[model samples]
Target chain A: MNDGARLAAADRSARVRHADRAARFVADAGQTDWHDAVLWRIRGKRDAAAGRVEGWERLRALASEIKEHTLSRLDEYLAAFEEAATANGAQVHWAADADAHNRIVRDVLRARGVRRVVKSKSMLTEECGLNPYLEARGFEVVDTDLGERIVQLREEPPSHLVAPAIHVRKEEIAALFHEKLGTPADADDPRLLAAAMREDLRARFLAADAAITGVNFAVASTGALVLVTNEGNADLGAHLAPAHIACMGIEKLIPKPEHLGVFLRLLARSATGQPLSVYTSYFCRPPPGRELHIVLVDNGRSRRLAQPDFRAALKCIRCGACLNTCPVYRRSGGHSYGATPSGPIGAILAPGMDMKRYASLPFASSLCGSCSDVCPVKIDIHAQLHRWRQVAAREGYVAWPKRWGMRVAGWIVRSPRRYRLAGRLARAWLRHAPRRLRYGSWNAWGRARELPRVPDRSFGEWYAAERGKK
Target chain B: MKVGLFAPCYIDQFYPQAAVATLELLERLGCDVAYPRGQTCCGQPMANAGCAPAAEAAHRHVAACFEGFDYVVGPSGSCVLHLREHVEGAPDARYYELCQFLVEVLQVERLDAAFACRVGLHASCHGLRGLRLARASERQEPPFDYVAYLLDMVDGVERVPLDRPDECCGFGGMFAIEEEAVSVRMGADRLADHLRQRVEVITGTDMSCLMHLEGLIRRRNLPLRVLHVAEILNGSGEARNG
Candidate 1:
């Protein structure tokens, strides 16, 4: 996602959205312990179904190591995939950023003499603002997956990467289906809602000039793109359309299908409690005479590949597993992120584009580690967040007042004599601390906490005086 | 053995009783305990909150204070963890959480102290994940070590199961106040989980996290009391259980 765009949007929301409402909007969301409660329920079910699998952690390590190893040789893999893709009668193109990426996708569709496109869920496309770009280019695009279809009719982009409609209540979905897809107007049943969506998308699947799909994983061994979905829209989109375009980020490559097993195990279990997704489709050949195009979009991922502390972020499979278990994400609804791919993953990914602009995004996380706990490949989310904060500070993204305050903090803590003097003074200050601070930015501290009244003397002073008296 | 007491700044002033309890616990556990006069706060608040460069001078000062002690112990897990795990390129790194020092270094099988109550376990993010005191890994089967194991050893202790069990209580030093809405919500969520399990007293290694929860618990009028895990391991006195 564009940090400039997200920050601009977040800033605009800040004007109209009060801090109390913003906080309440997030708090009154789904539930308090929802992420934790839901994740455990999902995990407990998976553990039981999968039986006792040994080497779970090693598998994650190997997956992370393999991705790390692959990122180091990413250029070689990209070149290899390009060669193999071209040999297989598919075309490959590289786009440096979101605008460049959108242009490439639009050009491909325009050159094909196509004005209508169908799509499967792809966060890469969302990051590049592809749908709007294509629509602006005068092409009509329809989303095929059920969740995407619900969000598409609302004329809003997805709130989630995977489960795009997670924020909408079921009743809201029932009403949406009633108005958009012409389900029985009086009906509130999800089955009826699904049936209505199925009928509406079926015709678009057949008639669209080309189909766009996001790649979950692209295997280097077979030079194929992997799309894991429950709806099988990727298969329909890739198969039925005369032409298929797959938009994928650069970090999606692994050595072989054999390596797919380790990731496959962790992905579904972490994502939605399933042992494996309903469909794991691998497309290597143009399906029975249809043309295939795979656009390898960077949009800042190449820069992400070079950073030691952050390169691991490229390993994301878009499983939404991290979001599913993030306590912070559970509270703050995705719209608060004001960009695609909102959640713990989005908070970190937003800054990769511009450290100065999206500095607040990293601070959004509580460093709870739930995202890390549920992550399939073990992204040390909070650690990466801590790393980004340091990066942002070093790069001059931190404001001066905070920086000066931290400097004062560092100075006092670093010296026993100075700290002691400060402590003595602070004690006196605390004894007289008013309901509101007469100075400084932290009136919030006084608003909630009752400042402990200072004792008559410092503990050290008491210890020394008592010893002398004795 | 010479055990250096590293009293974190906040605990030294606001909660000296915690330091006193720790010192007495150490002496009772049979160590030649000494509070290093020049000791100061570990620079974690600066480091984790994105000012490691500013934290450098403090890091050096901490290294100097406990440089020669065989075991440096602190009442707060989060602070002691900063010494063992956070400080980078510092000359002095040997340190332990009071429980870890007691269980790992001293190997005290019995305490002259005791406590009786239904206590919930609050795992501080630093002590739990950073210090590897809790079983935290994605590669192997995870384990809960020092805190859980220590709590299990205490007399009359009933460890309540929290929903996420390991969810952070969200007293993230400066974060609790900086991002009060989300931070307090997270702490409140953690507290409610412990409450659901009907725990009357909650205990953890990090006092600041407990302080945050204690504030909320007190404000909300919940009967739950917050305890530092060290205070509990020192065990309850006659009539203090109430």
Candidate 2:
């Protein structure tokens, strides 16, 4: 589906759009609890891993500084990277948007006469709609990562960045495999499922004519691309195929090779609590007779870079720490976001892509600031969410009811006399109105929870009666 | 020092006792506390809902009401945070959440108060993460909670441990209604942690959070009570229970 259609499918109503999708996910309370517990366990593991390192906060500060510096000089760094990569026997392609990005990839494949392709996990490709774009043109693209393959078979967008298909249970995966991949009917064992996926992907890897992977960090000084993964799928895909295409957001650039250590140290630990990713592949130049293609896609990143308040978000290393630590994200499944790179980071990033469609994304959180706290590069995530809310409101994306309600409430709260009168009126309504009327269909707060019991006297009234005596 | 008492809109209407507890507690702590009669609400509700322009007047009102106090103290971290961060007129005003005022400003060493109960502390998001009243679990910083420290000083008060210490109670003002399902689920999960700890009363610096949890507890008819930390610190002999 197109971004507009996908966003529309996820949304039902202005008041309860995101909440409706989340409600469906949490309808199975047992499953919701299990999901919450599992993510919380991951958060706990991250905490333990981070606590083991001395000066972790300082390291985060340094990483933030490095990203900020690179972003400030992004054009200079991009030109340098282009120049260096070209000298290193790599062809660099620039895409102004998603359509441009997809067209560039297709042209590269067409030029090379490539048919079948093996791909690793790349949120950039997912954002650009490359898989469907390639498959539509008879390119026969297959995702080699186990989790990516499961979602690919199900024709679903990944619910997470690091652990795609995290929302899927092992039993469901077994069922999906049984129907799609011809696994045993009773195969629920994790090891067995993984082994089954390995056997299936092994064949595709060998038959592939080209490969596509996402870049973790593009070293501008050295013109090298770095990809980190536990599955080693990127290595298999890029090496086994004659032509390799590495697509990356322009924000992935770091100034020097030395800066890679700071990110490498924090990436896996922040993501999955592994001290380091098992495979950290750096490809500076292709082997003889092998084609290396680097597509640097803008895809709304330049617009994001122009936003002072939100540009810090570009500093994200795609660590799922913000996702794991977010209370709202844990309870509300990532798919409920209905955007690529779901979670706190996505909430901030997606709105910049399409404000009207992804308007509810910013309001998805409680503004708890946990996302900002856990972020390795110190992006003020929750602050950015708040900023986006204001931006949405200014742009008239907020619902009319909320806008009018806030405007009216603002007038009342502005004057103490009007506020006291409103408080008294609210109290009287709560106390004297019939239960049915007070807890009517219009009252969303009263649906699952009781409204607060209205006291006979407000604190203002009590203060006047007792403490205001002269 | 003269302190201006700022009760959040919720506390002013639905939770007056929490404001009362705060007023009494501050006075007892030797603060020359005054509740400015012209005070109403901080612009937090409007601002949090993304209508910062609408909240501008309320921000100006807050600045006018609490203009001259050495510090402006409120019972809620959520409201205090809004005032500190977004009060356009009083950008430099010394607004503080109740706990921060007590722990940082007063340097309060002892409390002549006691609550003979096991209490589960819900670290309200604004107070814990926004106000920095406590160390959030997400941080790699050393463990410290000013609210817990004060609670520890209370005689006969046993603070219970929770599995998720600083998770949000999901009471994000309009979020309680807008995202009702996730909000209720989050509150329910937080309550489960407290119930697991076998605490009689769940307390937090922000009654807004306790208010949300209390709504759920009252609806479910759970065997628990909610109180603001001020009520406990103000001498909990007068505290009401479910």
Q: Write the per-residue lDDT of candidate 1 for residues A70-178, one digit (tens) a residue.
A: 8889998888888877877788888888898888888889888988899999988888878867876689889888888877776666766667876676788888887
Model 1 RMSD vs true structure: 3.5
Worst 10 residues of 2 chain B by lDDT: B233-242
Question: Per-residue alpha-carbon lDDT of model 2 for B1-242, expressed as tens digits?
Answer: 99999988889899899899999999998899999988888888899899999998988888899988899999899899989898865654499998899999999999998788989999998888888999999888989999999999888898999988888999998888889999999999899999999989999988888989999999999988898999988885335643
- State model 1's lDDT: 0.74
What lDDT is reached at residue B18 by model 2?
Answer: 88
After superposition, the stretches of candidate 1 with alpha carbons farther than 4 Å from their true spots are A1-24, A27-51, A434-442, A446-459, A462-470, B90-93, B136-142, B236-240
Candidate 1 chain A worst ten-residue window by lDDT: A13-22
lDDT of 1 at B140: 40
Clashes of each: 9, 0
Residue A199 of model 1, lDDT score: 84
Report clash pairs, candidate 1: A57-B138, A57-B139, A57-B140, A58-B139, B114-B235, B114-B236, B115-B235, B115-B236, B135-B143
